[model samples]
Target: MKPFTESMLNQCRKYMFNFFDYLPTKYQASARDWQVRKFVWAFKDGKCAVSAAQLVAKKIREQFGTSASDMVFVCIPASSQRKNEIRYREFSEEVARLSGAVNGYSHITVEGERLAIHESKSGKHVNDVQVINFDKEFFKDKKVLVFDDVITRGYSYARFACHLESFGASVIGGMFLAKTLFV
Candidate 1:
């Protein structure tokens, strides 16, 4: 296991504190307890992240179609330098596992964005992963739920939804494994 940096520890603490404050009084302690459980479980094995992501995805799926065929599962890359966050390969893998278990998806597809920070000839370039391609045919006239490891400010999700919309896909919803307190 990588040593948790002082910065990382501090960030976790700060996030917990904020989450604590966000809860109603009755839920404050319960929320903290759950957070601790999640932290420990998530680090224990890759299953924790995947499990949580699956739950979120499942909820979205339930709302859209009685059948998984009514929806497509699309996720951002688990690792993105532009996001400066931990990579979630295990989480992504788990999501795939859960999706397979449910047995009715029209298809599961991943969203791809260029990693290079491109510099345009005019001196301005987009450097982050932009939703550029999807399984176009599979999603045609299908509802999609976009998944991510976390959502701090919701900008990433917004970008993804917009991209899907542009392509004439109906975005049924978005799901995140965890939402950090700080944007």
Candidate 2:
């Protein structure tokens, strides 16, 4: 896993952990990279996604000593109801289940509609505040590990950490499948 520590517009110095770099569409010229991107985009299929989730689960177990029984895994809410339906399951929830951690999907919810950020060509086009609604009470004093498919500007995860901390939850860290470098 790769460590991320950088400051964004709204977020100060924060750290994020990612499994791999997501090759930008423009730079995915290699067959292997393209296939990996495809697999990430098509995670709803459950085969490759499940396998990748297992790997992430292993990393979580190794890095965070909190037994699976005590850990709560939360997925950044899906961008749209349609996407949620298509995916059939939230990637983070599945990873938690396979890894033996408690699923925390009900803790974080998406309240409003917003365009899928990744669908935009540029990261600046999307606003995360309009999309995510956090349940402050649900995470009180819990050890949480937040998960997302891909992170671009780190806005969503930063806000997640902030909210969790404010509500008295100890944010273990963020885990993502891939990260897009902001240039």
Candidate 3:
């Protein structure tokens, strides 16, 4: 894990872990790791692959241990509610269960349709496009772990962390399936 420096400095501390290296657009015949590319594509297309989620959960368990009950795990909301349901809902449940963390997947949510950040050059900030939902006291004085399929600019996790901090939550870090070429 490393400091998520893409986030604004002095925000509640945030660290991040990435399970795999990714380009997202690497399609060369000899680019290597076709499985990685396929897994990312499947996730983007709203296919929740339990095998990949299990792999991520294993890494989290190795790091945080089965005693992560104190940490609340959350995922960056999808572009819309339906996409979220199709992708992250089951993915998060399995990760949290296998990682021994509190399931906070549904705690944060999106308002409506929005352009995916990576699909655009000058994309909207994550917080601007998504409305969040959480219990007023759910995050109070708790450690939060943000989950995402990939970490590009880290804006989503960073913005979500700030929101969690606003409710007195301490962002322990983030867990991601992969990392893009840039941080």
Q: Whose TM-score is greatest here?
A: 3
Off by over 4 Å in 3: 1-7, 10-13, 26-33, 122-129
lDDT of 1 by residue, 42-107 (tens): 633444655565675465445543455555566654333223123344554454455532211223
The superposed Cα distance between candidate 3 and the true structure at residue 99, in angstroms, equals 1.8
User: What value of lDDT does candidate 2 attain over all alpha carbons?
Assistant: 0.68
Clashes of each: 0, 0, 0
Q: Pick the candidate with the highest lDDT.
A: 3
Clashing pairs in 2: none
What TM-score against the true fold does each predicted structure earn?
Answer: 0.49, 0.75, 0.82
What RMSD value applies to candidate 1?
Answer: 12.2
